[model samples]
Target: MTNVRKGVWRMKRELYKLLLMVLLAILPALSFAQGDPITQARIFVEQKQYEKAIDIYKKLYDQNPTNADVYTEYLNVLIQSKDLKGAEKLVGEQQKMRQHHPLSYVDMGRVYLAAGKDKKAEEQFDEAIKFINGDDLMTQQIANAFSTLGRDDYTLKTYERARDILKNPYFYSGPMSRLYAKSGQIEKAINTLLEAGPGQQGMLEDTKATLLEFLGTDKKNLQQAQKTLVKKINEQPENPYYAELLTWLYTQRDDWDGALLQIEALDERNKENGDRLLEFARYAAKEDKYEYAIKGYDAIIAKGAKLPYYSLAKSEKLGVLFAQLQANYAYKPSDVATVQKEYEAFFAEFPQYYTSESIRDYARLEARYANNPQKAVDLLTKALEQPALRKDIAGRVKLDLGDYYILTGKVWEASLLYSQVDKDFREDLLGEEARFRNAKLAYYRGDFQWAEGQLSVLKASTSELIANDALYLSVLILENITPDSNFVPIRRFAYADLLTFQNKDKEAETLLDSLLTAFPEHPLKDDILMQKAELAEKHREYARALTFLKEIHDKHAEDVLGDDAVFKIADINERYLKQNDEAKKYYELLIVNYPGSTYVQVARNRLAALQTGTPAIP
Candidate 1:
């Protein structure tokens, strides 16, 4: 009997030990599974399981009566469940326990508000603010509690009372600004935000961004901001922020000159190295405000010719002038000569630019505008020999030189250069450019088969310009030629275009007119007129150009190229003819007629500037 009892006892002891080990292993998991009572209550409340949430909150509050979060949640659940009496009793008990607690008063106020007892709620809210005294944590807690209950007035009062108690002037400005904005006192909001000062720059910026979100498109609001910023500038002239803000506001209005004025003053006042002016110049150029762009760059150059940004400014200024001429397609040879002189002076100071895009632009001005293909070829060839030139840059120079070679009738030389660049820069934009040029050379030599083949590959180029040009050329070849045989008219027209490029204009003109007479219904009618218009513009006979453009616009108004004629006519009036009223009318016509044209926005902008009397760049 004793031995059996001993075995049984030992088994019992082992069973107890196993049970204890299992419990030890699962204790952490059990705790994790239970999670936080408050979180569980919140989940139930969010799911609209208010009864379950109330049970959990009651248990939590009973377990920890001093836990403000638990008490607040319990009261909120009671109010949400429409048990107003229960919420009131709970808040009353909390207030009795912590009679002087500001948050207890806030809870009471929330309960009163939930019961539709407005006067009681207001009294409790006042008591809460009174109890807050000067404590930051308590004040913020009460203010947040009031805000949650939609008592924005009380929320503002809470912060204001705290600021007064603490004897701090700017303490409540951040929250007060939002309240002011909500109340439609926008100027008060602006003043409150400015009073916040430096330490709260992030908050200030966030509030400003919020203001801009709603007020950005409202001109009156923008003007209000402008006026306030100007007032601030006058009050504190040394504050760069005000001036910067005013400049930004001007840019938002597309007032590039106004922005330039502010930026110039700031740059001078701060004694900066023209970096700000350089940035403004680029912005003005992007907006097509060439006059303001030139002024901005000139301001930078006026700082000194040896500044870090001077060379860049000089180069970009030339580019802007070139763009102005291109936009209008009207230029005086004297104007071109003047720009070349500027390029010459700039190059004298920075010959290292010989291998850059600036030098290529200068060469293009000579080759295309000044009628000096040899100069373009010589400049690019010398640039190519520069050992320090970037390899990609050297490839670009080769491509450009090939173009000049084509213009000078060195077709074989141009073909060799193009092939070299294509081989060296395979799979790059420069290679695409070279290939496109070679394809054009093929077309110029009356080899449409070879031209179409290369163009088919280039239509998918990543370079937009190359792809667009390739597509345009491809369409011309396909539409003008029969499927089974080469088209003689297209071949002859291509030859004539090459002749025009080579400055053998009389021969080119004869060929074009002969083709027009030979085939009166040919698809190249508008195309031939466009060529003639370009030739007329080249000779500065803008009236003749306008005549040709009008012919296209009047007879072929529905053709694909009609919009080009309209825009060119508008530009000529705007620039060469100085008939701003007529220019405005033409631009408006283009806008109304071709709503989807890519030139519509450009026309609209020009029309606006014309109507507003924004001065054009000389």
Candidate 2:
């Protein structure tokens, strides 16, 4: 009976083992049927195949109808892909599956934050905190959410709450302090960090230093900033940043001695270049330290650096010192001369160092401050010798020379210079200036005829400035001369005067063409033509003007002014300009041309006057 019981029990155990094997074998197939899709979906998730993972997760949810993890993972995938609508759908799925998962709210907040829906994110974070019963990580995350939304007020409140619940002040104190500082509650931020424990003490000191440095720029806050910086230095004596800050603060307060002390300390600390010494010189100069500026420049020169900028720096310093001396002792001639000599010496030493423009400036200083026209002239001439004087400088120097001559009352010399400047160049705006000056010199010399003639040509000049000036002067001369009929003879005479003034003998001779054209039998034609001849003679164009006068004696024998023309030509050729041989023939022509005319007596008088060196009246 026992054996039969043992066999039956063994068979029962065997039967149970067979059933377990059958169940084990079927389990994988069932799981394949049920879980293969989820596994493939999870693979898709891991591989970042979001759309496929979302589709498979949705199918798995439909099949199981209660798997919250499937919906959560699907939502994560949606969030990863930045699909807000799909994430929102997963949110609904979570509500259906679990009713209240804190992760669902947190994840929804994340989606809202990613989508820039700040208010939605805030609400989701609030909901997450409630679902999690104020979990520390969740509360901190809520604070981060507020920070991301730039809601500093909410962020501060959330962090304050988190700090209280977490019982650790350091949790958000650093960020809160920064937020306070950013919001301009700097004092409060400093106090808050100072109240924090030793781990943050150094950070508080650094923050205080930065805030004080910032405030140092304001006039109202400078004293307070000074105190704060001094405290920072005393606390961290080895910190170079604090030392530099104190140096800058001193400069801001215009405390040069303090700044220098700090700079010297910095120089010792870092083995810095001597450029700081140059900067000290600049600061001293700004304080009207002329002697100190010179000393500074001399010190740099003594250093034997041989830098190009060093030369320029010394030059600038010397210029400043010289300018100060000039301004201060301008009334003292000896002082002025002394400074002027120094500047001259400096220029002589560095002749090729400075640019032409700088040299021009120095020349102006010599002219204005030292009253040395010769020095000014020499400087400008030297500038002209430079190879790199630009066209503008060349033109300006020419104009300056013309001005110098005009100022010195050498009007004729100025005119000659101006005329030699090519009209093409003179026809530019500067050229107009040269031409205008030449014409003006003529006008100033009472040579209106010459002035107007030059003006007439200038009126057609290329420069609008020259043309306008010429048109104005021509109109003025024309208006003054052509007012009446009797002035016709005066006009003819004035034409000769104008031509003589301009040294245009040929044109003066041609002006007779107008007289001959206007009145063929005009009585004054002999006088008019004779005047042309006299102008030519006066200008040493005697051969040319004499030809016209001889024609008058030969052709206008009966004319009244012919004898006068002959005698005048003889007088001009003889005594005044020393052309004796030409004088005899014109004297004879005067006696032959109009024997009964009044000029015959004067012609004989001139003949006698020329022979015996007596004045002749006609």
Candidate 3:
């Protein structure tokens, strides 16, 4: 009995030890199930709490050294955090766990691609594809991986394989066409699109339009570009852009008649407002059809819609009519006179509506053609009095009045007018013009010394025009005059003349003042007045010159310079001012009143030139 109890006690001790071992195992498993570090890490990783996830993963890795899934999760979390070194170390561990596994290679490739190591990604993808199963999904994944590497050839091959297996070739047609186009094989691209058949014709049309736009500006490439658009236009003849392109092409070739024909065709098809009328007007004007141009202007005016360019067009047409009348002056004097009267009537009707410059032009015509210098001067003077005249116009009128004074042989009067103008607008172009004329007036009176002195100052004038004139006249005076000359008044007049020639008008004017002040009763007073008129002529102040000449005949009729001034008025009106009729009248007057005048021969030659429309020798 004692032996049996000992044996039972030993059995009970061994059973107690086995139960304790089971309890230990169960307690560890229950603890892991309740609080799994790896599960917590995965939850953190999913929530994008990477740092906490990484710490949990590292703790799990230390505890479960042989768990491949834990190693993978840790690596992925490191990769998610962009911890490349940690991810790489985890990848090495994964390789040991699953040698040559497709998932392992793909994961590595994904990591490499994310890191922008494209070559490494490509190598990994290539190795993964070699071991890939031939399932369509697997094949697609491999093909997509090749596309990410930008390996065009491999991508195409993979796509072709997909197409062969899938048997829906159209599925890849669009992408393949784009690829072909990108490779500069446009014809192949077109073929690919056509293979997709009529269902894709809309897409084909879009492609065609894009290609045409790209090639349109290249004339050399245009010939080879397929005329799909022309074909499309023939198929739909009423397309507006097609018609417009054809018209543009005609314009490019300068084929105005052809362009007009196309426009007529367009009009026949539909009566839209097609700018054809304006084009026709421009064409007729180019062909010198003043009457037709008037018709065009009238058409636009009749519309009464206040178009943007209506005023400008009407102005151009009126100008054209005036030009036509002026060109026929020699052959059709009556017609010219009638046209001049019509223009006058037009001005009378719309005097305040036209631009001041246009009104001034009309006045000039009246002066030249209607033998109405007083009327012209009156109009210009009235315009000048109105503060509405532009600065330029005001200056021009002043210059014109000075011209008239010189023309009438009132040289002193003309000089005073020019001086007043110079002072009023000293920095303006008109001021420069006035100064230049004053200097020339001095030169005309045999006052070389005065003219030269004025010219010398004018050489430094602000205007290039004044400076050029000063340089020219200064050189002329220096060459003409002797050094140390003693004829004081004559020298002063000569210098003033030089100033006028050089466009140093203000200085020439001052010299003229000094001369008049120094010798108010000198015998050359009439000569000085005549010189002013001559200066006006040199400066294109014809009307001023005429006024001066007329004054010489009126105020100092018996003086030799007075006779000379009257003859000069006739000569300048005909030759320089382009007032042929006025010139003819002046020449006739000189012949009638001064038969022995020195300008008769030249006047006769000028009369012949005007009658025959040829320039006569001076």
Best by lDDT: 1
Provide the TM-score for each candidate, comma-separated: 0.64, 0.36, 0.36
Candidate 3, residue 258: Cα displacement in angstroms equals 7.3
Write the residue-wise lDDT of candidate 1 on 1-618 in tens digits: 699999999999999999999999999877876797777789899999999998998888888889877886788789889999989899888889998788777777777877889899888888888886787888888888888888888888888888888876668886787797787777877666665653355554564565575455678767777788899899999876667767877988777778988998899889888988988888888888888899998998887867888888888998998887666555677888888898888888889988788889889988988889999998898898888899888888888888899888899999999999999989888899999999999989988889999999999999978997898788878888777644878988999899998888889989988988987778888888888898887777999999999999999888777898999999888777888888888899899998987789889888888877883433
Best by TM-score: 1
Those runs of model 3 whose alpha carbons end farther than 4 Å from true positions after fitting are 1-299, 302-312, 319-342, 353-355, 366-372, 408-413, 461-463, 483-618
Minimum summed lDDT over a 10-residue window in model 2 is located at 193-202
Scored by Cα lDDT, where does model 2 land?
0.65
- Poorest stretch of ten by lDDT in candidate 3: 220-229
Candidate 1 local distance difference test against the native: 0.84
- Candidate 3 lDDT over 455-512, as tens digits, reads 8878988886689768866765564465653467766776676556435566776787
Model 2: pairs clashing at backbone N, Cα or C within 3 Å: 426-431
